[model samples]
Target: MLVGDHLGRVETEALLEMGRLDGALMYCMGAPESIYAGLALRQTLIGALRQEGHAFTETRFQAWFAGLTTLSDDPSHKARPPRAVCEAILTELTHSAWPVLARTAASLISALLAPHDLQSPDAAVELHTVNAHARAMVDALGAAALTPLPALDALHHAVAQSTVFAAVERAEPALKLVRADMRSDPHQAPRWAVEMLYGSCLQSAGALHHPIPLVGLIRPDTAGDMEPGEARIIRAATLCEIMSTQLAMLAHASRQSKRAGALDTRSTSRAPDVLALLSGFGAMRSAQIERVLKATRLGVRGMVQLLLTAGEIEQTTVSGAHLYAVRTHPSDRLGITAPLEEAFSDDAMDEYDASMAQIDRLLNNAASLQR
Candidate 1:
C-alpha cells in the first residue's frame, strides 16, 4: 500500500461497520503524521456525535483505535527518540549532568501540563492558551535543548482521549503479550525494533488515557546494556517514545484496518534483539555494523554512543584504529575508560593527565607566539 493514501474515511467507516475496529485502529496507529492530524480533527467531530459516558467493548474499538496509533513511533510526532536520538539520550542520561537533564525534562513536562514561564530568548510563554496542554508541552520542550518532547507529548495527550483509550485498555493483555515477547527475547529485535514496540505500548496507554506503565520486567541486571534501575527508567522513556508512534498510527489506520491487506509488519517489537546484537559484537568495523543492522553509518555511531554511556560497552584507539568492547568487566574498571580519572588505574589517569598537559603546553606556546 502507498504510505498515506492507502486508507481513507469511507474505508474507516466500513471497518467500524464490520466490527474491525482493532485493525482499523492499528492502521490509524501506523499512518503518517499529516494524515493523523486530519484524523484527530475528524475524531473531534465524532466525539461530539456520541453522548457522554458512552462506551464500547474492546473488540468493537480496536480497529478504529489502530488507525489512530499507526505512526506513533515517529520522532517529530513524539518525545520518544528515534534510534539515533536514543543513543544521544543514553549518553546524556548517564553523564554527570543527568540531574540537570532530568530536571530539564521534568520542567518541560510540567510546562506542558501546567503553567510556567519558559526560558526562551523572547521569554515566550510555552503555550499560547492556558488550557492548550498539547501546545504547552510543545512550547516547554521547544525551550529545552531536546526538540522532540513537545510534539511527542502532544501526540500522547491526543491519544489519551476517551475513544482511543477504550480500544487499548480492552486489549491490554495482548499488548502485554507483546511486552513479554520483548523481555523474553530481546535478541530478536532489529536496530529500530525496540523503538517501534515501545511506541506501540505508549500509544496503547495513551489510547487508554493512562500514564505510561513501567516495564519493570525488562531488568538490566538480568541481561542487557542498562542496569536494572536504569533499565526501568530507560524502558519507561522508550515506552513513551513508542507510544507517540502508536498514537499517530491510530489516526492513520482508522480507515485501513477493515481492509484485509493493510497494516502488516515483520513484528510488533524488535528493539531488544537489536540491542542484544550490538552489545554482543562489542565494536565491529562501522561498515560491519551497518551491513548487519542495515542502518546508516550515522545510526550505528549513535548506537555505539548509547552502549558506551550505558556502560554496557566501551571503545579504544590503537594505532589510529578505534575498537569497541562490551564492559563485561566491573564498573570500577570501566570508570577508568573515560576522560575522567579512576583511582585504581594509574596508567589511564597518567595518560589522561599527560594529554591535558600537552594541550596546556600547546596553548601556552600559541599565546607566546601571538605576543
Candidate 2:
C-alpha cells in the first residue's frame, strides 16, 4: 500500500477524521505558543509521512516533555546503581510535576488542537500571553523545590504569580494563522501529544509500523546512555508503555479476544513467530523468518524488537546478508541438542537477505523529531 494510504485502512482513520477544533482548545495563557509549536509538529509529521513510510514518533519524545520527569531505580534489580543515576523514569500521569504538567500539557493540547490562533496575537488582554505556562512551571518548580507542600495545595502554587489559566468560553472566535516552522520531525511528536489526542483527533501510533502505545517508553540502547529518571518512576513508565499497547489492542479487538493477524504486531497471533523462528530455527535471514510467519513483510516486522530489547536476539550479517539467532541458545543452556535445518521444509535462505531500511528509517525519523 502507498505510505499514508495504509493509514486509511486501519482504525487510526477513526482518530484522524476526528481532528477538528473541538472545545478542548481552551484560551489559556500559553495557548498561542502551543498552537505555534503544534503547527510545527504537524508539518514535521507530514514530512515524515512523505519520507519515512511509517512512524511511531511517540517513543522518542524526550525533548518536548524532558524537564517534566525525573528518574528512580527498579527495586527488583539487585545489582541496581546508585539513587542519583538510575534507569527508571517518570511519565505525565505519574510525575509529581503533574500539578504543573497538567496545565502545561493542557496548554500544549490546546495548541495542538488549533491550526490557528483563537485571537489575534497583538490584541490587548488582561494578562499578556507569552510563553507563560512552561516558564511558570519551571519557576514554580524551582521555588517549590525545597519546600514540601500538600497534594492539593501544590497546584495552587505550581504557576507563576502572573500566570492566568482560566476556563475559556466556546463562543470565542478563532482565526487561521500561519507561522514559520524551521524544523519538524517525528521526535517532535510527543508521546503524550498523540495519546492525549487519541480517539478524538489522533489515532494510535504505528499505522505503517509496529503500534507503540503513547506511553513514552524509551531507554538507551547501551548501559551508560541515559535520560533523567530515578528507579521507581522508570518502572512505572515501562509498565504503562507495554500495557498501553496491549490494552489498546484489546479495546480495538474486543470482538476477537484472541490475538490474530491484527494490525498491531503485539496484538497479532503471528507476533510470536519472530521469537519462535529465531529460538527454534537458529541463525536465519529475514526472508526465511517472513516465510515461517506466512505474512507480508509488514506483518513480519513483529516481536523482533521485543526480543532484541530483552537481549534475547542476536543480529549480525553473514556474507552481506543479515542473519538472526537466539542469543544464549535455550537448547544449549539446557544441555539439549537442537536439530539443524532438517527440522523444517526446504527453505534455504542461502541467497536471500533482509534490509533494515525500515528500522533505519524509523531511527532517522525519531532523531529528527527530538528537536
Candidate 3:
C-alpha cells in the first residue's frame, strides 16, 4: 500500500481538507462515476471544509467520509449515501489492488510532474508518501462518489463527427445537455459525454480552466455497437492533447508539494511557471515553452492571454507561430532578464531535455492507442 509517514501529525480538520482534495480523485479513479465527473464533488468538498490543517490518519479520514454523507444535498434533503456504497469505497482504497494502481498512476504522474532526470534512494519512499495522502482521503469520500451520469449517445455522436476540432468545438454545448441529463435523465445524451463536462460548464464562459481528457479515460459502453462510424470524438490524438495538459498540471502540483508541504497545494496557480519560462528563454512560441516546461497548449494559451491583458507579456509572430515573452517593463518588476543560461541551472536543462523525450514517447503511444 501507499504506507509511509502518513499516520500521525494529522488533525481531523486537516484530514477534512486533505481528504476533500485527494478523496475525490482516488474515488473517481475506480468509481462508476469517472474522475472527470468529480469536478463538482471536488468543489463541494473544498467548499465544505471550513477547518484548519494538521496531520492525517485512518480514523480521521473515516470520520470525514462519514461526515460527507450528512452534507445537505439540497435545502430539503441531506445526502445520505448507502452503507454498501461506503464500504465499496473503503475497500477500493485499502484493497491490495490500490498499491499497484497508485504506483502506476503516480509513477507516470511523478515522471511527468517531478524532474524524472534522476532518482534518489528516497525517491520511492517519497512517491509512497505522495500517494499516502491520496489513500487517506479516499475514505473521507465514502459513497458520495457514485455518479451514474452516462450518455452513450453523446460519445456515438462525438465519434461520428468529421474532425477532432469540430467535436471539441461542439463539446461545450453538448456537455451542458449531459449535465441536465445528470439531474433528471431528461436528455438522451450518453454518460461518457458527461465526462467531457468540466467545472463552470453552465456558465457563460467555458470551464474557467481548459479541457481535460476525462472523455479520453473511459470508453463508450456502446463502442461495439457503432463499429462503422465509431471513429470517436476522443481520438488518440485528442487524448494526447488533453492528457498532455493534465500531466502538465499534475507535474506542477508535484513541484508545489515539495515546497509547500504534501497536499498543501496551490501556493499560487499555474502562472508562475509560464512567466518564469518566458523570462528565462526570452521569446519563445507556445510549443517551445510547452516542450521545455510541459505546459499544454490550451493552458499555455490561457496563461498567455492573461499575461497579455496584464501587459506582463507581449506577443510576436516568428515564421508563423506566435511567440510570447515577458514584457520588457514587467520583466523589470519581476526581476527577470534574458540570456537563458543564467536563469536555468544545468539540471534544469537536463530536465527540459528529458521532458521533451517523455512527451515524444507519450505522443507515439497515443498513436498506438488508435489501433
Judging by TM-score against the true structure, name the best candidate: 3
Clash number for every model?
76, 16, 15
- Give the per-residue lDDT digits (tens) of candidate 2, residues 203-250: 111121111112222221211323322322333334333333332222
Pairwise TM-score winner, candidates 1 and 3: 3
Sort order, TM-score high to low: 3, 2, 1
TM-scores, one per candidate: 0.17, 0.19, 0.26
Q: Model 2 segments beyond 4 Å from truth?
A: 1-265, 329-371
* Tens-digit lDDT string for candidate 1 (72-170): 222122112122222222222222122332332222221111112123222122111211342233234334433122333333333334231111212
Error of 3 at 86 (Å): 5.4
Cα distance off (Å), candidate 1, residue 52: 77
The Cα local distance difference test for each model comes to: 0.30, 0.29, 0.33
- lDDT (Cα, tens digit) per residue for candidate 3, span 1-371: 11111211122222222222232223222211222222222222222221111122322222223232222223111111222222222222233232432222222222121112123334344324423433332222222332111122333344434132122222344455556434432112222222323211211121122222143333433345444223233232233343343333333322222221222225654655555444422455666556555667887777777667766678765335465765654324322323222223476545645654554575457446744
Task: Report RMSD (Å) for each prediction in the order shown.
Answer: 26.6, 24.5, 22.5
RMSD (CA, Å), candidate 2 to true, equals 24.5
- Rank list by lDDT: 3, 1, 2
Model 3 TM: 0.26
